[model samples]
Structures are given as structure tokens and as C-alpha cells.
Target chain A: MPLMFDHVYYTYDASSPLPSKAIEDIHFTLNEPFFCGIIGQTGSGKSTLVQQINALLRPTQGKVIVGEFVVDSSKKKMKEIKSLRKYAGLVFQFAEYQLFEETVLKDVSFGPKNFKENEEVAVEKAKKALKKVGIPEEYFSKSPFELSGGEKRRVAIAGLLAMEPQILILDEPTAGLDPKGAQEILALFYDLYQNGTSILLITHDMNVVLKYCTSVMVLHQGKLLGMYSPLDVFYQKELLSEAEIDAPDLICLVEQMEKKGFSLNRQNIRDIESFVAEIKKMKGEVK
Target chain B: MKALPIGRYTNYDTFLNRLDARFKLLAMILFMVVVFIHFGSRAMDFTFYGLLMVMVLVFMRIAHIRIRQLLRAIKPMWFMMIFLLIINVLVVQTGEAFYIGDFPIHYDALFNTLYTFVRLILMLAFSLILTATTKPMDLTYALEWYLHPLTFIKVPVHIIAMVISLALRFIPTLLEEADRFMKAQASRGVDFENGKLREKVRAIISLIIPLFVSAIQRSTDLADAMEVRGYDPNGKRTRYRIMHFAKRDVLSLFFLLAFFGGMLALSICGIDFYAFIL
Candidate 1:
């Protein structure tokens, strides 16, 4: 089902004397499966926005609609909150810490079992997910706590993947991972996105957005600035600075090259490989 | 998460806020002792206790603690207070009894319940005042000073103080971490709110294990950072902010001492000041 946020707002400690608005009037809709990147500075409400998708945090005002499930502030308790969570798997930041099961396989199977999948089916889904994330069969029986940091993170992601959620939301999943591990994790998500699962990634890295995201949402001070295509977002230098986000290095390099009297096509140049190919084509045309 | 009423130090410029932390801690203990002093059957004893309760409220006002904070401080104990009232009314059936649909509510039971309830509220309010006025580091220093005598017997007061300060320091951090862990597990479809008793227990285990793992991880990181910064718990440490009792503190202590002595004497002699007035 299409995911939609109809003028959603979230306030921390709404009943307290000192209430803080975390996100304000956030409106968005995803009609189809797509890789979307949510970029914001710290305390800019990116995490708060994604949390409403799975009903982990109900909006203080307005409603979040995920397929058939609805979480509205007016409702005291939403009967379909658990089902909504099953549809949208959220991989938290530092998810490795959440690994508490005795074995890696059992840890990954925890999510599916929670959603009421039988023992054999849960283990099967968990094993498939672990393999998809590239964890070895040998590590399945080992204690999750004994695994390396990267392995633990993969197993955590595998835990979510076992549930086979339609919409996969990750909050800075690559945070604290080494560069190679981060890229591998991002590529894994990209593969899932290609396989038809909608991906919503919250990240501070502009490069990841440029490389993987089809569309980008910029949040500033608890408000949605706008959602634009990756190229459109990078093209607006003023908006980037306004949101306190740096343009990806590739974009900056392309801008510098264009400034020096070189007429190069910037529309399709998303990564270093494409930029290099564009330069080569330009050199040939000049000759 | 609801704001915890205790240990929430509000920054305000007032006599109690500026009072030495040592004196504030000592005053809190003395106030609690006075609150627990047994009252006789005379109305004068109850009247004196009521006056002491009023004095605590006055101190709370002087410290700039708002009425909202006082209510919040007492909010968590409300269920216990009601339970206490019910138990007292049921068990202490003495004096004149008023029947309410076959349930005999004794006059003495009501009086005893009121006394205990008032005492609890006064104790909580005064402690809240002490905590709200005193800075945490200063409180730790005061605690170290209190435990100074233990150092003579080879107890490491400095280490104990350091441990208390560190625990206080990480309270917020741990709370934030716990919130994060709860959300994470909730996202995984661990239904914490609506579940059978067995399922709820399992959900809590899920939340708790993650919290415990992360807490241990944080403590290790903290220990490493402290070691890197040359924190030797057993080593002698120089004081930065030394506390000195001011004239106001000395005067307040004398007033408290005189009040305690008068109340003690009245209780011992069974004097009925209200009866004399009548």
C-alpha cells in the first residue's frame, strides 16, 4: 500500500509543561517502490519522521497512513499498530546493540517469530536473510555477541529482513561502520530496493543520497523544506546551504569544471564513474 | 518520557538555591526526622505537626519551586497514598465509627491516615526542594564530606564520591538509551503495550537485554575515557568549588534545632497547647 503522511506533527512530552516539537506538518506520499533519502542536520526531525511510519511514535497532530493501517492522534489506541510494524521494518542506528539472542540465527529469527511465523518458517526466513546479507552459515550457530561489529550489524539488519517488510526504513544504518562496511551495507539495501522493496534511508551523508537515492527529502528545523530528485536537490546550491548540507564532492567537482569554460552535461552525472566518462567524452569532442 | 521530579535541579536565584549543599542535605535529614516524630492523642500534637508541614511548603515556595513541580513530585505516590488510606481504614477500627453501607470507618483510622499522608507529602516536598536547589556535583561533595569519617577506617571516600557522581552523570544518558532501545524493539513488532502476561514479560526481556548490553558497552567506553584522562579513583584530588556555611545557613540550623527541641519537649511532657488555648 502507498505510504502517506498527511500534515503530520510530533511533539516530545506533549503532556509535559515543557513540550518540544520534533517534526512539524510533514506531508509526503510514496506511490510506488523507490529508494528515498531523508537528509537533515542533527535535531532536524528526520528520525522522528521515519518513526511514525511503523507506529513506533504516533503523531501528536495529524495522521500517518501506511497501506491499510492508520495511526491518528485522535485515536487512543490503534488496533493495527502491530500489523503496521510488520509491514515496515525499521533498522535503528547502532542496531548491533539490539542483538540479544543466544545465536546469530536465533537473533535474526526473532523478528519473524514476533510477527507469528512458525518456528521452521521463521528459521528459514532468517537463514535466507542472513545469506542475502552475506553472513556465513558457520556464524549462524555462534553467539551474536561474539561476532565482530560489522557481523553484528549485518545480523541485526538480517533480523529486520527476515520479516520481509514492504517498506524498509533505516536510520543511519551505516553510522560507526568502516568505509568498506558502510558501502557494502548500502549496496545491500540498494539490491533490496531493486528487488521492489521501498527504501527510506535517513542519513547525513550527501554522497550516499547522490549515489543511491532516486529522490531526496530535505528537512530543516522540524519542517520539510521540499522533496526533489537527487540531481534537482544538488543543483540548488542555495537550498543545500540553507539546509546546512554540503553538496556531494562529485557535484562540487562538476560545478568547478563547468566554471572553467567547459560545456559538460551535468544532468546524468551522478557518480565518479559517470563524471569521469563525461570528461573523457568532452576531451574527445574538443579534439 | 515523563520528567522525573526528583534530582531535577532547577536554576533559580533564591536563599535555598544558594544555600550550601552540605547544609541543605543536613537540613533535609533533620526535616525528615521531625516529620517522623510520633504525635500523642492531643490536638496540640497534631496541630504542631500540621505547622511543620506548612513550614516545608513555605521552604518549597522560597526555593522558587512551582506548584506544578510539587504536584508532579507527589503524582507517582498517589496510588500508594490511596492504598495506605484504605488499609488504615480497614485495620485501625477504633474510636467513634461512622458506618458507610456496613463499612465502619473509625475516626482514629481517618486521623492516622491523614497524619501518615501529610508526613509523606512533606517528606517528598522537602527532599524535592533539597534536590532542586542543590547542584549534583555539590551534592556529591557533600556526600563525600559526610562519609569523611569512613576514610579514617580506610574506606575510599573519594572513590565512593566518584562512583556516585558518575552514576548521577549517566542517568540522562542511560534514560535516552533506554528510550532508543524500546523504540527499536517496538519497531520489530514486539508489542509492549497490548499483550498477554507471558508475551508482555517476553517483550520486557527483549527491551531489558538490549538496554543491559548497551549499558555495559557505555560503561566500558566511559572507563576507557576516564583512564585515558588520568582519573585515579584512589589518588588525592584537589577541590575546585569549596563550600562554606554562610550566616543564613548557621541561623537556619539554629532555628531548626530550637524547633526540634521544642517539639521533643512537648512530646515528652504530653503538653496540650491547644487545650490551654481553649
Candidate 2:
């Protein structure tokens, strides 16, 4: 399913005395099966932009189109909002805090049940999601609160997965996790994307964007600077500095090498391993 | 939810905002009493209440509060105001009566309802002035000072004041957290706005449970933080902010006392100002 935002503008507390524009003139479209990263500093409207995808927040102006559902500012009510929610699942930051059911299976099934799946089907979907996240069957019946921090986060993600959303929007999914744990969670999402799920990841880490994202959208002070390929975004030092975004260390290293008269192919460097291989190939050519 | 006007402090460099909060709190209580005063005569009551309304409005102006804010403060009481009107019309049947169809509407009932509504508005406006002008920390210090006398009776005034301050401080934080949780659950397909009663209850449970868990966790974290900073609930703490009663506060107190005494005299003298108007 394709997701599109048309001239979307959102203001928090619009009727209040101190209205603030959280996102302004945000226009973007995501074709299916694309792993896109949204990068900005804190309070740059990344979360506000994603919330409109599933109609958690209606735009103050313009509209958001998600597949067949439309959330427009002119309309006060939409019947397809619930369906839209089921089609686009949002995993909040520290999502594990949202888990409250007595058992892990029940917690995971909550989303499917809310979407009107029958009890048996909901339980089955929940079990499948749990297994997909690698939770053992024996732990399915245990209290979700009994799980460790990482396991609870996985369970929370499983809760959303049970809804079978085509577009998964995660806001800082790896925040506050150990390095290995964060890598494991990102790998799981990458695997899902590999099997044809569209992923929208909101992150402050530029390295994560270069490593995992096909394209990246830059937001600066609630405005979309532009959307570009990951390599293009990383190569523009002026745009990165203007947006107050730090270039990933790999890109910085490659730039330093180029300044010292060493020719390096920026296109071939996406991750540390690939960048290392590129350097070795350069050495071989020089020899 | 939009930020409620009550308990929200707006920063402004107005005269009322600069006044001591202890005096402000006392003046607020005195104003409330003044609003509740009745002269037992329609003309006197109307005239006195009208004057009090003007005074309250002037106070709001001095505090740099706009009409929009005053309306916002009264918005939440609309349901209760309507309920009060309905109850008065139904239960109190006195004075001249007229029938609309079979139902009889009494003149006294309507008059009483109007008076009650005006009183309520005046009370709310007074409170709005107090809260909008004073900072939360200053309010707590004033409360602690007032409750200092209770320490002689073995009350934990310092602890009570601390609790109140913390509660005030966390109101916005908790509200923001609740909003985030609601959105998270909504993304999972919990339709909070439209659902049957059972479904609504279930939806609310989904929200409340998460909120409750997060609240507890937050409090635990806060407790740990306070402990790490060596916050001793029973220890003697020196005052960081010492409040002094200024000349303006003294003048305001005298004015309040004079107004209260004059109202008491009118109530006792039984002078029917309505008869004089006639």
C-alpha cells in the first residue's frame, strides 16, 4: 500500500492561546516495500508527521492518504479510521510501557481483537507474531510484566504485528536498549521489510539511516527540507550542517581520506564493512 | 486535551502577578466569601453582586488576563450551570408563576438561578486571577505559611506542602503522558470515541491500565531521584524563598476587611435597598 501526505500541516493546541505548529507543509509519498528513515533533531516534528499516517492525529490542514483511507482536516468524522489504524501500526517510543495484560499472549492479541478478529483467529495471529519475534511458547502464557526490558519491547512490537499492518511506523524503536539488543530489534524489522513490509523508522542516529534505509527524509523545524537517497543525503555536508544533523562517522572518514588525495567511491560505502572493503579495493588498485 | 486554565500559571509582569502569593490566596478566599454574601433584598443583592462582578473583572484586567481566558475558565462549568438551572426551575416554585404548556415557571426560581450563575462566574474569575498570576512554587510556599499554625496540632505541614507542590508540578507531565498512551492504544485499533458501553469500558481499561502502570513507574523513578539527592522528608530544611508581607499586601488586607465588615453590617441592619428603589 502506498502512503501519501499532501500539503499536511499540524498545529498542537490550535484553539488554545499558545498554538504551536508541529509540522508545516509536510509533503511526501512512500511507495510500497520501501525502508525509509526520517531523521531530525528532537522536536523537529518527526513523531508528529508519523502520527498522521494512521489518523492518530488529524492534520490541521490538508490531508493524509493511506491506501483507501483518507484523513482530511475538513471532515470531522471518518468511518475508515479504524481500518486505517489496522493497516498502519505505530510502535511508540518505550512501547513496552504500554503492555498491561496478565499474559504475553493476551497482550499480543489485544490489537487483533480490537480490530474485530474472532477470538480463535486473534489468538492464532498473536501466537504467530510472538513466535516470529522469537518468544518461546512456554513464555507466551507468562505475565508480560515478568519479561526483561528487551523481551517486553519485543512483545509490544508483536502486539502491533498481530494486527498485520502493511506499513509499520516505529518511533525510536531501539532507544534505551543495550547495543546488542538494539541491533537485534533493527535486524528483526529489516527481516520483515525484506519480506515486503514497508518500514518507516524515526531515528536521530545517522549511522542507522545509512545502514538500513533506502531513502531518508530530512525535517528541520517542522518543515521537510527534502527527501533524497541515503548516499545523496550523507554526501551533502552543507545540507547536513544546515539541518543540524551530524554525518555518519563512515562518511566523515571517507571525506577525510578524499581530502588527503585518496580517491574513494562514496556510492559503494553504506556501512562500516562495505566502507572497509572499498578501502581495501583502493589499496589493491594502488599496488 | 487542551490545557485547562485552572491551576495553570501564566507568566506576566503585571501588578497582580508581582504581589505576594500569600496575600493573593487570602484575597481569593475573601472574594469567594463576598460572592456568597446575600442582602435578602433583590435590589441590594443585585447591586452588591454587580459591584463584585466589576471588581473581579478589574482584577482580571490588572492580571493581564484576556476575555478569552475568562471564557475558557468558565467553559468546563457549563454543564453544571445548566444542571443547576434545571434543578432550580423544577424544585423551587415561588413568587409569580407562568405556564408554558402544563409546566409552570416561577419568577423567583429564574431570578435565583441567574444569581447563582453570576456568583459562580465571579468565583471562577477570582480563582482564575489567583492561579494565573501566581507561580506554583509561590502558591505552595503561601500554603505552607498558612498551614504553619497547624504544626502546633501535630500536622505535617511541610510534608503536606511538599506533596501539593509535587502534584502541581507533575500535572502537565502526566497529561502529556496520558495523551501519548491514548494515541498508542488508538493505533492498535481501540476506537475511543465511538463504541458500545461495554466496548467503551474495555477501551478505557486499555488506556487506564497503561496510564496506571506508567504513573507508578514514574513515581518510583522520582522517588529514587529524590533519594539520590538526599531529600529527607523528616529533616529540617532551611527556607530558600522567604516571603515578606509588603505595603500593598497590608493595604489589600485592610480593604478586604473593610468590605467584609460593610457587608456584615448591611446583612444585620435589614435595610431593604429594593424598597428604596421602589
Candidate 3:
């Protein structure tokens, strides 16, 4: 099922006398098995936009449809809100804080148990998710707090993955991790995407976008500048500047090299290795 | 993720908003005491109370604050106020009793409860006005000024003032963090809304543990930031925004004193009180 946002507008504390718009006129759609990156400056409403996918926040003026579940102001008490969150699991920044169960296994099982799964079934799903996220079985019965920061993050992701969401939404999932840790986590997300789950990552890291994301949505002052394939987004320098989004270093370096008389024809090259290979080929041609 | 209405400040150059913070704080305290202690059941006392309420309403109007804001401030307290009224109405059984269904409603109990309730509401209204109109920094300075005498005993008054100001500053941050924690837990299927009493308590525990952990982490970061910025509680520091006593502040203080004095004299003479009609 394709996720769609229809002119979604949201105001924080709208009932108060002073209502400030968090997101406005946001429109986008994503089909299954796509890895999408949402990039924006701070306070540009990236977090607010991704949150609507799970009905954690309802739109003030429009609608957000995740699969068959629709989130609008009128759906405040809709029976599908719980299911919507389950289907589109949102892992917040510092999600490790959400773990309160005595054991990591129980913590990961919380989501499935909440969805009415029996104890044995939920435990089985939790175990599979834990293993999938690369957590060792010995740590299953240990306290989440006792684990290192990276381990805690994996456990947190396992908790959401156990829910078996069709679309996984994460806000700055690699915010506080080291480079290796971040790479490992992003690899996990890529694996999940290859397994048929669509992913929406809210991040400001352009490197992650160019590397893992298939398409990117650029937000500026609560408005969508454009949503395009990752390479296409980088080529739109004017639009990227308007959104204050920086293109990946490799893309900028390639553009600079092209300006310096290097005739490179490779398109949509995302990684450093591919761009270097293209540059080496141009050097060989010159020789 | 901003939750909790602890009354944010509004910038308005109105008579109340422009009053000297120290004078306003003192006048509010005295006014509350007079309203509570001298509220006799005479005709004149009721008239004075009515006039006091009218003055407050006029002040709010001049300050550009709507009645809805006042009502919103009182919204959370409605449950407690109603509980108080019902419990008092049912528990006290002296004086003339009337049957509203099987419960005995006593005249004296009802009168006393109503009197206290009005006092409580008025007290809350004045506090709301104070918080809504005055900036928190001004309040912190006013508190520092009022507590300056404690320095005679070598109580580290500056440090105390710094702590109070920092606490006030973190109120909004902690509230926002708590809101985020609640939402994060909710996403994990922790049912915060509907559950049995035991289950609800367990859910609350889930929320509090995360909130407490985040609070500690935030405080550590804040302290480091303060240290980096050369903030020393015992160090001598100069004020950036000096307090000034303007003409409007003097006028406000004069009016509050005169109003309370007039009420006192009228209550002594006993003119038209006895809870006046409505």
C-alpha cells in the first residue's frame, strides 16, 4: 500500500490563543519497499511530518493515509489509530528511554503484546527481531540499561521491528552513535527495506541520504520544496539551497571536478567508490 | 511537545504589566490576605468583594487578556474545586438541611463551602494574572530583592536567587521533555488513556522512569553549559536589565492600597454584604 499525505497541515497547540503552524500544505506519496529520507533544517517540521504517518500527531487541516488508516482531526477516537501506529512504527530519537521492562526480551515484546499477540508468539517475534538487529541471545535476559549505547539503540529498534510494521519511521536514529555504530544501524535499516518494509528516515545527515535513501523529500519552512530521487535532488542546487539542504560531499566534489574540465558521464552515482572510479576512468582517457 | 499550562508570560504595556514587580508581588499578597480574612457575611463585605472582582476584570481587559484565558487557567482545577464542594456538601451535617435526593444539603455547610470556593477561585485568578502579565525573570529578581535580608545570616542569597532563576528557566524544558517521553511510550503501545487502576499505575511508572532519566541527563548538560559560560553562583555579577519604578507602577500601588483600605473601612461600617445576590 502506498502512503499518502494530502495537503497535510498541523499547528502545535492549536486550541490555545496563539497557534503556530508546524507543517503546512505538505503533500507526498510513497509506494512500498522505498527508502525515503526527509531532510530539513531545525524547526522546519521534518519531525512533525514523519509523525503524522503513525497518527502520533493528526493533521490540523488535511489528511494522512498510511495504508488504509486515515489520520485527521475527526479521527481522534478512531479504532484504527492503534493499528496505524503498529503498521507504521515510529522510533523516536533516544528511543532507548522507552525501554522500561526488566529484561530486553520483555521490552522488545511490549509492542507485539500491545497488539494482542500471545506471550509465546510475541516472544518468538521478539527473539527473531533481536537476532535480526544483531543482538546476541545472551543479552536477551539482560537489562537494557546495562548495555552500551549502540546496543541500547539496537534493542530499541528491535522493539519496533517486532511489531512487524509495513512502514518503519525513525527520527535521527543515528544521532548520538559513533561512525561505525551509525553504519551498522543504517545497514540494519537497508536490510529491513530489502525485506519489503518501506522506510522513512528523518535525518539531517546528507551522507546517509545519498548512501541509503532511494528518494528524498526536502522541506523548507513547513513546505515541501520537492521530492525526487536522491541523485535528482542533488542536481537541483537551487532547490537544495532554498531548503538549506547541503548536497552530499561526493556530489559537490564531482560537480567541482566537472567545472575543472573532467568529462564525467556517470549519472546518479551515490557513493565515494563509484565517483572515484568515474574520476579514474576520466584520468585514463586524458592519459 | 509543549504541554502543561503553567501560565506563560505575554508582552503587553498595560498598567498591570508595567507595574513594578516587587510592588505588584507585595500588593497581591496583601490583597489575598484581606479578601480571605475580612470577608464577613455582611452586605458591605459582599459589595466590596464584587467591586474587587470587577476591578480585576477591568484590569484583565486593559491588559488585553481575554476571559477565555482566565477560564483556561481554571480548567484543570475544576475537578478539584468540584470535589471540594461535593465532599463538603455531603460531609458536614449541621444547620438547616434539605434533601437533594438522599443526600442532606446543609445551609451553613453550603454557605461556608461557597465562600471558600470563591476565595480559592479569586486567589487563583490573581496568581494567573501575575504569572501571565509578569516575565519570569522579573519575578526572579523580585524574589531576590525580597529575600535579600537573608544575607544578614550569611545564607548565600545570590546562590539561592541563581537556583530559583535556573529552576524557573528549566520548567518549560522539563515539561517539553516529559511530553516527548509520554509520546515515545505511547508509540510503543503503552496504553496511557484507558486501563484498569493497576495497569494504569504500571503505565505511569513506564513514563516516569524515562522522564526521570532524561531529566538527569538534561540537568548535567545544562550545568556544563553554565560552567562553560562562566556562571559561578558565588561570583559577583552585574545586572543587564535593571528594575525601574515608573509612574504607572506608583499609581498601581496607590490604587491597590486605597482599594484595600476602603474595603476595610466599609466592612467595619457594615453596609451591604451577606454574599450580595449572585
Native A-B interface contacts kept, per candidate: 0.76, 0.82, 0.62
Best-performing candidate as measured by DockQ: 2
Rank list by DockQ: 2, 1, 3
Off by over 4 Å in 2: A259-262, A279-287, B3-7, B82-116
What level of docking quality does candidate 1 show? medium
Estimated TM-score for each candidate = 0.91, 0.93, 0.92
Regarding TM-score, does 1 or 3 come out ahead?
3
In candidate 3, stretches whose alpha carbon ends up further than 4 angstroms from where it belongs are A276-287, B1-5, B42-45, B100-104, B228-230, B266-278
| Pairs in steric clash, model 3 | B42-B273, B42-B274, B43-B272, B43-B273, B43-B274, B44-B272, B44-B273
Candidate 2: tens digits of C-alpha lDDT, residues A198-285: 9999998788899999999999999999999998898898898889999988888988999999998888899989989998998899
The sequence of per-residue lDDT tens digits that candidate 1 reaches over residues A1-287 is 67889999999878654589999999998875989999989999999999988887889999988888888887477777778888898999889988888899998898998999999999999999999988999999999989899889999999999999999999999988889989988999999999999999999888899989999899999999999999889979789889998998888888887898778787778888888898899889889
Lowest lDDT 10-mer window, candidate 1 chain A? A74-83
lDDT of 2 by residue, B143-219 (tens): 99999999999899999999999998998888898888889899888888888999999888888888888888889
Q: Who is ahead in DockQ, 2 or 3?
A: 2
Q: After superposition, how far is residue A32 of candidate 2 from its true place, in Å?
A: 2.1
| Ranking according to TM-score, highest score first | 2, 3, 1
TM-score of 3: 0.92
**What lDDT does model 3 reach?**
0.83
- Model 3, B1-278: lDDT tens digits are 33234457778777778888998788879778777755445445555668768867986787777777777766777788788778888788898899989878898777777677677767777777788788888998998999989989988988888888888988888778777877887787777888789868878988888778777878899899999999888887899999988887788778878977876776566545444655
